[model samples]
Target chain A: MFKVKVYVTLRESVLDPQGKAVTQSLNSLNYQEVTDVRIGKYMELMIEKSDRDLDEVVNEICTKLLANPVIEDYRYEVEECVAQ
Target chain B: MFKVKVYVTLRESVLDPQGKAVTQSLNSLNYQEVTDVRIGKYMELMIEKSDRDLDEVVNEICTKLLANPVIEDYRYEVEECVAQ
Candidate 1:
C-alpha cells in the first residue's frame, strides 16, 4: 500500500478571507507576534498496491478533482505503507 | 521569522463524509487503485521574530483556535523563514 499526502493552497495572487479573519483573531487574542496566515487543504489517500505509475495517477487525480487550478495550487508526497 | 505549517485532520474514529464522497468519485473516474480518502485542513502562519518560544505560541494557538481537540488532531512543522 501507499500513503499519499496532498496539500492544496490558494494562489498567492488571491486574497484569503478566512486567513485574514484568523490573523485578526490571533492578534486580538494577544498573539501579536503573528504576522500573517494562509489557509489551505490537506488530504491523505491510501492506495492499494498496484502496478500503475503512482506519480501519474496521483497527478491526474490532483489536477482533475482534488484542486481548483484557477485559484489553488497543489503538491503531494507518496510513501510506501505497510499493510495492516 | 518563522514559517509554521499546521495540519488538522479528523480523528480516526470520526466519519469523514467528504472523504467518502471523494473516494467514490475517484472510483467512478476509474482510479480503482485508490482504497481510501481523508480530508483535512492545512494552514501556514508567518511569525515575526520575537523572544517568545515559537513552540509554546503555536501549541496554544492550535489548541485554542485552529483545531477542535474533541474530534480533530493537529500537527505542525516550524521552519526559519528568510525575510523577503
Candidate 2:
C-alpha cells in the first residue's frame, strides 16, 4: 500500500482571517517578535496501489476533489505505507 | 520565517464518506489494486519568527482555532520557508 500526503493552502493573494486572528492573539500575548501568520490544511490518503502512475493519479485527485483551484493550492507526495 | 504543517483526518473510529466515494471511483476505473482510501486535510502556517517557542504557539493555535480537536488530530513541523 502507499500513502499520499496532500497539503492545501490559500493563494498568496488571498486573505486568511482565521490565521490573522491567531497571529493577532499571539501578538497580544507579547510575542512581538512575531509578525504574520497564514493557515493551511493537510490531508493523507492511503491507497493500495503504487505500481500505477502516482503523478497522474494525484493530479486527477487534486483537480477533481482535493482542492478548489480558485482559492487554494495543493501539493502531494506518495510513499510506502508505514505507521498510519 | 517558519512554516507549520497541520493535518486533520477523520478519527479512525469514524467513517469517511468522501474517502469511500473515492475508493469506489478508483475501483470503477479498473484500478483493482486499490482497496481502501482515507482522506485528510493539510495546512501550512507562515510566521515571521522562529526565535520563539513553536510548540506552545502551535498548540495554542490548534486548540483555540485551527482545528476541532474533538474529531481531529494534527502534527506540525517548523522549517525555514523557501516559498509562499
Candidate 3:
C-alpha cells in the first residue's frame, strides 16, 4: 500500500476571508507580526495498488476529482516515488 | 516569532463529502483497500510575542476566532513551552 497526501489551496492572488479572520484574531493575541494567512485542506489517501504507476494515477485523481482547477490548485506526494 | 498551527476537521461521527469523494477517486485509482478519509483545514500563524502569556492569548484566540466551537474543534501548539 502507498500513502498519498493532497493539499488544496486557492491561487496566491485570491483573497481568503477565513484566513483573514484568523490573522486578525492572532494579532489580538499579541501575534501582531503576522500579516497573512491562507487556509487549505489536507487529505490522506491509502492506495492498495501502487505498481510503479503512481504519477499517472495521482494526476488523474487530482484533476478529475480531487480539486477544481479553476479556483484551486492541488499538489500531492506519495510515500514512495514511482517512475514516469 | 512563534508558530501556531490549527487543524479543523468534521467531528468523527460527521459525514464528510470531500473525504468521501476523494476516497472514491482513490478506489478508481486502484487504491481499493482505502475505506475512509477525512479532509481538514490547517492554519499556521506566526506570532511576534513569545512570552509566558502564550496560553492565555492562544486560548482566547481559539475560542473566540480560531474555530467555531459548535461545529469545529481546533488544537494548537506553541513553539516554545508556556507556563499556565
Candidate 4:
C-alpha cells in the first residue's frame, strides 16, 4: 500500500480571513509575537496497491476533490507502507 | 523572524466522520484504490523575534489555541526567516 500526505493551502495572493481571526485572537490572549497566520488543510490517504500510477492518482484526487485550484495550492508526499 | 509550520491531526482513536465522508465520496467517484482517509489542519505562523524561547511560545500556542488536547495532536517545525 501507499500512504500519501497532502497539504492544501491558500495561494499567497488570496486573503485568509480565518487565519486572520485566529491571529487576532492570539494577540488578544497576549501572544503579541505572532505577526501573521495562514491556515490550510492536511490530509492522509491510504491507497491499496494498483496498476494505476500513484502520482497520477494522487494528483487527480487533489485537483478534483481535495483542493480548489483557483485559490488554493496543494502538494503531496507519497510513501510505501505495509498495510495493517 | 521565524516561520512556523504546524500540523494538527485527530488522535488515532478518534472517529473522523469528515474523513469517512470524503473516502466514500472518492469511492463513488471511482477512485476505489483509496482505502482510508484522514483530514487535519495545517497552519503557518510568522513570529517576530522575541526574548522568549521559540519552542516554548509555539508549544503554548498549540496547546492553548491551535489544537484540542483531548482529541487532536499537533507538531511544528520552526525556521528563521528574514523579515520582509
lDDT rank order: 4, 1, 2, 3
Candidate 3's interface RMSD, please? 2.9
Off by over 4 Å in 3: A25-34, A50-52, A80-84, B2-5, B9-17, B25-34, B50-64, B67-84
> Residue by residue across B2-51, what tens digits does model 3's lDDT show?
66666666676767898888677677766665666778776666656645
| Candidate number that wins on TM-score, 2 or 3 | 2
How do these models rank on TM-score, best leading?
4, 1, 2, 3
The better-scoring model by DockQ among 2 and 3 is 2
Candidate 3 residue-wise lDDT at A19: 85
Instruction: For residues B18-75, write the lDDT of model 1, one tens digit per residue.
Output: 9999999999999999989999999999998788888999999999999999999999
TM-score of each: 0.96, 0.68, 0.62, 0.98
Candidate 3: residue B36 Cα off by (Å): 3.1
Give the residue spans of candidate 4 off by over 4 A.
none
lDDT per residue (tens digit) for residues A1-84 in model 2: 777777778999999898788678767876654567766765566666557687787777777766789998888878887655
Q: Of all true interface contacts, what fraction is found in model 3? A: 0.55
Candidate 1 vs candidate 3: which has greater TM-score? 1
Candidate 4 lDDT tens digits, B1-84: 999999999999999999999999999999999989999999999999889988999999999999999999999999899756
lDDT of 4 at A8: 100
* Better candidate by lDDT, 3 or 4: 4
lDDT of 2 by residue, B4-29 (tens): 66666667887878878877886787
